[model samples]
Target: MFRRQFLGLGAAVLAFGLSLCGTAGADPLPDLKGRTIVAVTENAYFPLNFTDPKTGEGIGWEYDAMNEIARRLDAKVEWKTSSWDAMIQAVQAGQFDIGMDGISITDERKKQVDFSDPYMVSEQFMLVRANENRFTDAKSFAADPKLFVGAQAGTTNYFVSVSDLLGGDDKSPRLRLFETFGASVQALKVGDVDTVLMDKAGAEGNIAASPDRFKIIGNGLGHDEFGFILKKGSDLLAPVDAALAAMKADGTLKALDKKWFYDYRAAH
Candidate 1:
């Protein structure tokens, strides 16, 4: 399935999005054809969105999950990659049908864009070098702005690090921009960044690939939900929710989670 078929629905999407409003599951999904959904992601967050080490293909939980949802909707997907910061904003700006990343559904983010039902839930966590106990949790990280807690710019982790950890809720992190989470993880391994703010699930992949280099610190900063993001009012949301509902009800979501994520966990 290719994207060209969806042009008509794409145009319909542009015209009707703003007028359509309600929860995702409020109405039944419409029959859609000749529609391609342009989904955006940053292949930085492992297990969710990441470049495959073997074929260099973009592969991860989000990749597989979105493709599955698209199949059920009889829609095709064209994926665009960018820095994590721009992915959400692009969806908000109507540049894409939806954004699929390990995007946490935070209240602050909901103000900017709408989200599907949460697909995966994981605790916000920190990764620090082995034997480095000087810094542990968000509170300790906030004690010193001089310490570099690396995160992709404009992400929830970046926001959390800047406000809740380094600065205050109102402040942004001192700002160390990286092209991807892999680079930031490398920085953490070498101590270039004192810590890396990541989801517990994502950090697990990094830890599996590089043992003795990184470890989770402190209790998780608490749980966060990940979801597919779209513009505030888009026709596409209903079908996505519908597909997700089917996936959730039949245990498909759990099975897929275990396939990509080591543990089987669903975001409720």
Candidate 2:
């Protein structure tokens, strides 16, 4: 299974190099002039897509990448917002031309909507209080029935906690479900839950945003790749995929990763 394969890989095997540049003389993409693409996101996933607290504007890695993709494809982007729970279905129903919110590409989802080439891959980690000492890793935390974990219902983080970290009981009383990822983190902040499972990117973003309040614990639980989502059989898929390939070949993707993941971490 994909989940088992991802979890079994060591950290070294999961690590990626951002320094890799794209190859020279890659094939050019088809011109998409005069096309306008509508994109949707939750704007709640940090580092991927989030509203800037100070500026009150949507900004982050996905926003940057999507803007670049639009520029390269000669298309204008019209941004819209939706709740994470509704995003995939909304896209599948043709309510949006494209959707992105750190969405993981799974075979199940592929049946409803097509995914662009993967834009980012990340690992899951345990986010705990800064002074936490009761448990250091998943196994230790699972052994202690008193310890609670917060995760948004239906998210990969939630399933990971249920199956991979805990004992595969979906109805575990120790699991506290939230409506949003940020809400789960907030639950952890107030000591409502002992920890939360978050992707390494979001964990870093939250830790950077509140270094004195939270910290990541344990090795990464598993790895997952994120991709842009579109309605199945949408005409935009080929051009979007080509744009992503060009960005990968031209080092734009690596540059954005460094800017949002590394440089942003340092500045924040």
Candidate 3:
């Protein structure tokens, strides 16, 4: 969606104008009581999703969103952490009812798994070392063979970086694939990769935490939209949509946005 359209929807949502899904009128929110809804995440999209430092429990924005959805549905949540590449596959295979990582909404993805209303919208940004700024421009990365850009497998950012920046060929800068965003970022720090491309929020949060040592690169990868993942045609999509709409309408989304992404707000 265009920023204008998105902002329009945001206004309507804020003004309580979202219409209920026709199917939801009969769907009855499902009897989620005593039942478990599995949620898949990478635990690498910081603030949006991450593992607790001490307890190792999953915690973050997506985590909080799932918790809210589960409570509204009267269901218990079973969080399943997985590689970013495996998240959509797991949900498509019916291993989980929802995938809550900061997965972007795209036309290609709509074929594999259904997505509810977008919970957040933003662009992709590259993470690079503070001292080096070569990756800030596409022209530099496009010309250099020495600079390697890292992106997780099965993500739109990877595809875009390869097609748009790398010219869909192997002769240009190479894309090093990581199983997780965290791993990819670590690769950057260890000098295994020249830059790591990820969602804007994650990149911003990491940059904020270590402002003296890191920064986001490039003009940003444009209009990335995020939504919860569900098996294509799953019965649960309607209620999930409704809950997300309610969350946005009631200001819960902004509050949660502040909690997780205070320094950088996730686009709506």
Candidate 4:
């Protein structure tokens, strides 16, 4: 997620209004003339996007949001999956028309890919095993030399572990790297790592999955916003943004957040 000011629901709602200001016209929604757009995401980001354990099919907030956007625009979406590490580069290479994996709209990433309006505001939190209580927060965790943090490499989670918890030491031996967020969480489960930094939504999803196994402690660590990614100067940018604005105006976005983050619980 792109680092920014801590935004409540009101601020997130205001962000949608601001995005609408960019496209000047009587109609905020656009029709894609039945065109098919290819969209890609890592099907491992819980609540945002992930495989439903019961059906083994991809489904989450992003899936619903993108499908709704396509419907509103009168377009068809072709879903594809890629590793989180390769998603941005693959989209930039023109392999996908759109990408969404709770991608943060950071200035550095903006240089490589165009981003849609902020869809969700999130904050990083400490996810730890429920039974353990060695450290309560970032500061307490940092004080313990035996503590180790699990994080996916080249992600907001990893950077936050390094910058916020580890005093900007990217090479800290206490940090353990994994290929995916799921993997990092797995490490935490098996005692390979003590904690995992995750967005509040994701942390909640995991906690819901195994309430007796995991819990989030401490206040949020960083303020961030999520947006969909497109290739630099992609032709679909305006239409996608317009559809998002319409969704926000009609309460579709808020409803989706409520469904995936607050209501939906995976069967264990």
RMSD values for the candidates in order, in angstroms, are 9.7, 7.4, 6.9, 6.4
Residue lDDT tens for model 3, 95-158 = 9888877778888889999998999987777678888866567778778878888877677767
Q: List the residue pairs that clash in candidate 1.
A: 5-34, 6-34, 6-35, 6-36, 142-165, 162-173, 163-168
Q: What is each predicted model's overall lDDT from 0 to 1?
A: 0.72, 0.82, 0.72, 0.83
lDDT of 2 by residue, 86-173 (tens): 9999999999999999888888999999999998887789999999999999999999989999988878898889986678998899
How close is every model to the real structure, measured as TM-score? 0.78, 0.90, 0.81, 0.89
- Candidate scoring better on TM-score of 2 and 3: 2
Query: Cα deviation in Å at residue 77, candidate 4?
Result: 0.5
Off by over 4 Å in 2: 1-24
Candidate 1 error regions (>4 Å): 1-30, 136-146, 167-179, 263-268
lDDT of 4 by residue, 1-268 (tens): 1111224553465345435532544464676889999999998888888887668888888987898788778899999999999999999999999999988778999999999999998889999999988999999999998999999998888888998889999999999999888999999998999999999888887888767999889999987789999999999999988888777776668766656665565323
Q: Could you give the candidate ranking by lDDT, starting with the highest?
A: 4, 2, 3, 1
**Angstrom error at residue 183, model 2:** 0.5
Q: Per-residue lDDT of 163-258 in model 1, one digit per residue for the tens?
A: 666555434445576777778788888878888778877777677667677788877765678899999998898889888886776556765555
Candidate 3 regions exceeding 4 Å error are: 1-31, 170-173, 263-268
Worst 10 residues of 2 by lDDT: 1-10
Candidate 4 deviant stretches above 4 angstroms? 1-28, 266-268
Clashes of 1: 7
Q: Give the TM-score of candidate 4.
A: 0.89
